[model samples]
Target: MDNTAKSAAILNGRLAEETTRRFTERTFRIFNDADHLSHLASKWKNVAADKAQGHMFEQLETIKFNYDALRKDSELFAKTTASMVLGTDPVDIIISDGKKTLREVQAKSCNHAAASTFALSDKKYAEMMRLSPSDQHAEIEKLLKQRIAAGTLKAGDYEQTLRNLKKDLQYDNVSSGGTTYQQATEATNQSVADRVADEFRVKSALTDMHESGKRAGNMGAAVAGGISAISEGFALFKGEKELGEVTVNIVLASAKGYATGYAVTALSKGVTHTASYYLGTGVASTLARSNAPVAIASGVVNASKSMIAFMQGEIDAEQLSDEISHTAITSTASFYYGAVGQAIIPIPVVGALVGAGVGYFIGNMIHQSGLLALGDSAVVKAAKAHRKQVEAMCLAAIPEIQRHRHEMEQMLSQHFAERKAHFTDAFSAMDAALYEWEPDNFMTGLTVINDQFGGVLPFKNFSEFDAFMKSDEALEF
Candidate 1:
């Protein structure tokens, strides 16, 4: 790497960083919904401009009319009803006009219907609703006792309390339960709550899960916001679209259709250097991209700028999948200097070795770390662990099988992020090497770096990653 190229490399790195910063700062709106994209939204307005649009508008008008009519009709004729599950009445309604009293069934229908919906009318109905305890008529008391004895009414407990119940019937030696109004009310409330809880099967575990998910979802919004800002910042900075020089031309990712974005550049033809090694981040401000945050957001970025955010975020999802770490990663800037550096190097064989330079970089990268790529043995353990862990997570879900779903999700978060970050690093590292660090005697460099010991790397650390894949070992609530 010559001084001029180093300067150019640094400058190009700064430009890439500027692109990423612009991307982040420009996107990540908290209130913004990610699912909404201009491509989709634009279609809605475009309908009116074409034959399709005009037809859509007419259809929409009909739908709008139907909606309004349906709502109006529902409001006019329908009653807003909630489930009113009453514990079978302990006492029957009584009727009295300060004179004779009569026992009434526990219902609210009158002899005649009224025009007002949800409201009943009939002087007899009005008179029946206002019965007082003093009315204490004998006939009502007899019916109440008969109903209780016959088990026609399931709960006599509430009606038995003389103090708690406001009755129109006289208790001719009928009031014998020691109950007060307040106690009766409390018991009633408790009974209702118990019934409701039973109906929904609302146990503690489900409650906790629901709340945890809700909280995580809320926090995820903040995460989403932060991601958006970083995305936008990168975009804004890269608005100039100054094409970067191809520093390393690694194997074109013939990765079947869509595995693109694998080119690299070290030295922009015209730019001033500011640092020892400038690292290119991502483009696309406001990115609706695959979660490649590990590549641009962590130690993978300008290793010199900030490591904590990138590193933490990289491993964040690795906890989800270890490939995250294996595929995408961090390597020194010196590790991937391709043709551009060779261009500036001007070492004895310049034009004679033009094709060889690119070829050598690719072959060396493949022989080295690239051999330990995604499907490699090192990543096998982590991958298996992640698969089983996720499967165990789903399998354990049933008629309330496992209690520690939280722990499962945590494990998921760690492994998923790990896998994502790992792959991001690995794949990117290949390109970086091809373009940024074209080492002399590529094969020697590959062999030296290939077998070297590193963090037992998440890809190789399978035991802990896949420890919980059995039903027998599952946690109990």
Candidate 2:
């Protein structure tokens, strides 16, 4: 192959590897890491007992369903979004009327064949074969159209299926058995269609926000995250029949923080614009920059409020420390990247990329400096002590977590058996009726490992998680 072709092949191979890695990396971590296994096991033990065990297993099933559903929904969302962007309709199913296309289906299913639905059984098939060639073709066409009109058969993606009422739909042979006589069938795949619609709305909203002249990167992140939070929150409510106070609190807090941060950033940008236009470039211009002051004030006020609440016995010290660290890190990052660094770049698309890269580097440097300066603070010391305590607690729970793994698996097995009883098809039985305790993919593997193991993973937070994930051992795993 030529150099260009060789380069393309190499990149394609890398893309495949990355995709595979994304799906399998979590499983690798859970299976190989003792700490993660123990933590998961502990969680399972706490929840997986008696009547509650069934619900816990169901949650696992829901998670697996969510993963597959999300992947499919995401693909559909992308296709639909692309079509919208390009000013075209998404066509997945179509009907051809002999000489030309009869219909391009964008909806969940076509209702063109709603009049008559029939499937030929084994006896009916034998009788059908006795008919002459012309008679057989005519009968088959009539039956097929009836089925199509009734939405009885799987039309499949974009393949041309004959739907002409004027001519005979030709086929080499007619084979029939089992449910050939389709009377009335409810929409079997509407759930997937509904999920795709939900994803489409989220994608559309994000696109709308981006087109509305907001900074594309920031707007994209906020919109996507906000939509996801809403979707997940709704799912939890629907599944559990009740929302937890802690869950609600966390969601509200996140939303509040995001809004506050956005306001601060926008106000800073406005101030920067005014200063640049009136004050001109100098020491005055530098001093006039709004991000540093706004960010610092925002962080201090939020963090200090939590800290003061803790001192007054209104909240725990751990919660206060978390607020402090979170505010400090986030505000520091925003100040550098969103404000100071972004101002240096003027190009739209290219400038965003350049600004983000420079901003992250500057942000990291400032964060490290700030951390060192604040090392002597009581909150910092408390956070460190709390971390140690958490680690010790997790380590101590390992054996108990290990014990619960088998119990959880037994619960899952029962759950699976009950579901299997409702299905006759082996494939369907395997798909929905069975739950694997030891899955090869990340999400299930993590769930299983934590349920079986006594303690959680050793990683302190996302930074540690990242470090471990990028390690040589992780790659090999």
Candidate 3:
């Protein structure tokens, strides 16, 4: 094969691999959720069938939401990957010169029928349109008044429902004359349209910032980590055994190391928390995408940074007393960055924090190495004693932890009797929902590939595309 064909084939293989990886991750998330909800359903088994069914439905919805998310991301990944392979600027692929963007492509993508019709109004537009002008106007006023009356909304606030409604109507050439039916009717229509458009615009801006932040956080963390690693490696290579002679030196270094190591982690966690209050693509998958690289950078930088910070006197040794070993263990654990290690704390932010705590462990290890190399003085002995105390306390907590675990297990058994059928049904339904989208997802990905090559694919339509994807050659992938 020619170089171009070989490159194209290689890109195709990569895209396929990436898509499968994404799909598997999403599937695991969906099933993990299904399992959790299944446990919840079992707990609620004593409750009414309707309540149990509600939990079951929630499990199904989680599966569908995650499945669709996977498809969308996979298609986006494919588009970007194809653009790169085809020598098109992938970053600008969504909006090339005088072209419709990824948003337009998404709208046109082959997909399932939506369960609900798109409404132009936030209100019951269909039902409201049936009413006379005066009634329609009254309904609009009622909604506004209801919102204002509720403590949740304020009349004077710029984004307040009532305030925005008045402004939208007036801006749209629809007078809000209190007594006129015609004016009220026009105002009602204008309000809904304006509100929806404004919401979409606001949401889009926030989404872009959030997505940009995800990449930025990863880059920042990676850079800091890389620098730290290089510096530390150089020190170790030179046989520089002592991090610092004084306690003040060690503390400053530990702080600086932590800052470098967790910079991306902190930003990613912060952005994720803030974005949760709004709408966006999401944080979980993006974080997952960058975790391995971030982890490696974090671990290396953290070790080096802590040692350097101590030598530079950024941290006081006084601050290092009694906490060296704990710090060492915690730092190491936090920066370890294994999927299974973080799995115990499902919430990424919490997991990161826990991991951060574990970083102290690494710091302590470094401190011990320094103490041994530089000769243990009074300060070092005190620090060592503190570390021993910390270890003793941790060992003392084991029995209590085991007792708590036993009690929790016994309690769970009480609520989980004879509920295997319900769990099976929920999981089966989730799998079925996911399967329905699989074909469309494959076609969508192929469409992106074809578009990237400027219609170079053998297929002329979706049917042909589908056939091509299902062939033995494609299946071999």
Candidate 4:
């Protein structure tokens, strides 16, 4: 048995009853019926979808009739276990397809597209914005004091303010700078005290303001220093002004203080603009492959993972459409055992064939997918042998592949966690008012991630700020 089928059998055992009900019920029902049992022995096939493979069955009765084969079997489990022992990368399914089909399915060429953001060294952004966290910390402390004064928070607000200030200041030198959080906080506190003290003894408001000209000076100095360093360091990608706009885009939050937070939200909601956002410079430019190519390959890889997860989620989808499906695990019998029962499952020739041989031969006939089966295949054995040819390659690639898979899985987990919270807010934000949406941009607004503070900040572009914030509570403050 193939790993997929083995995994499927494992999944059937481990799968949540409700999950099966929710996703694959339609396909399940079709294979599980009784009448189709006799006809199941014929040649079987699958329709290749743009993104995934389709599961088919002879009929419901055949599926219902031969519950033993479809159910997880020890022999099937052992076969899959042995395959894994030999070592195989699940992703090789697609890679083999690319190799055989002579297409861009596996190894894709990378190009530079501006939209997919690269992880760049923003040491300059950090160094220039070094004073920002401290300034914001001071501002937060003062605001905390005011909140306390207004009785907005409990008396413990002082300690909370100090704690938050201390925490916020730690990230200042994350990329660069010598000052510690405590040191920065102390500096900001001193300026805050000087500004407040000046307010107390001064007679004229202008004099007091002048005495506190320091705060504006600090903010201005921060901004000016940032701009100057940014210019000198050339931190941003230099691209055509009209075609690609450089942005030190500030994401202001409702929190009592100012801190730029540009959290990466889900790409599922991001605009699929067809252009390279980066001009191929710095580390981004130095990448072995062009960013555009990396992104396209990454997209294909991302889609593959997404499709597997989608299919898993739909394991029980057959229940929904009342479809039943079966596997081609072959079992043999003698004359003494044969007369007792024939596996009268759906396609007669197919069911008989499935019983006589492994799923590989019959499934191959239907889909012409050599990639799907490899138990006795030359191609698979060669790949496995080549992997062993390099001692380090076998050890390194397999574990690394597994590790990377887990890492991508974790990334997706984080992405979905963030996505659910955002979509929840979005649906809540629109509520009954969502019905007012129109193509002319009347009541409905773009749902793009224009702003970085929170949620899917919707807009075709960052051209409209007022419209983007009109709904989000996170943005409201």
Ranking by TM-score: 2, 3, 1, 4
Provide the lowest-lDDT 10-residue window in model 4.
256-265
Candidate 4, after superposition: displacement of residue 95 in Å?
85
Off by over 4 Å in 4: 1-388, 432-445, 448-477
User: What value does the lDDT take at residue 233 in candidate 1?
Assistant: 45
lDDT of 4 by residue, 146-212 (tens): 6557764343533343333331111212111122223322222334323322332122222212222
Worst ten-residue run, lDDT, model 3?
A: 107-116
- Decide which is better by TM-score, 2 or 4: 2
List model 3 lDDT by residue over 1-477, tens digit each. Answer: 111211121122112222233343433343344344435444555665433333333222233333344434332211221223433321211211123332211100001111011111223221111111222333454654654567443333312322223211111122212122322222223333244334433343243334333334443344434444555656756877444533344344444433432343333333432443243334444543434323433333343444555668875564333233333333333445333335667764455444444443444455555542234434567778999999899899989999999999987775454344444554555455468755444445455545544665455556776777777765432
Cα lDDT tens digits for candidate 1, 336-416: 332344356665334213323343344334423435333333345557789999988777775355546767888999977
Instruction: Quote each prediction's TM-score.
Output: 0.16, 0.24, 0.21, 0.14
Root-mean-square deviation of every model: 40.3, 43.1, 45.4, 50.4
Rate residue 425 of model 2 by lDDT.
42
After superposing candidate 1 on the true structure, give the runs of residues whose Cα lies further than 4 Å from its correct spot.
1-204, 240-477
lDDT of 1: 0.29
lDDT of 2: 0.36
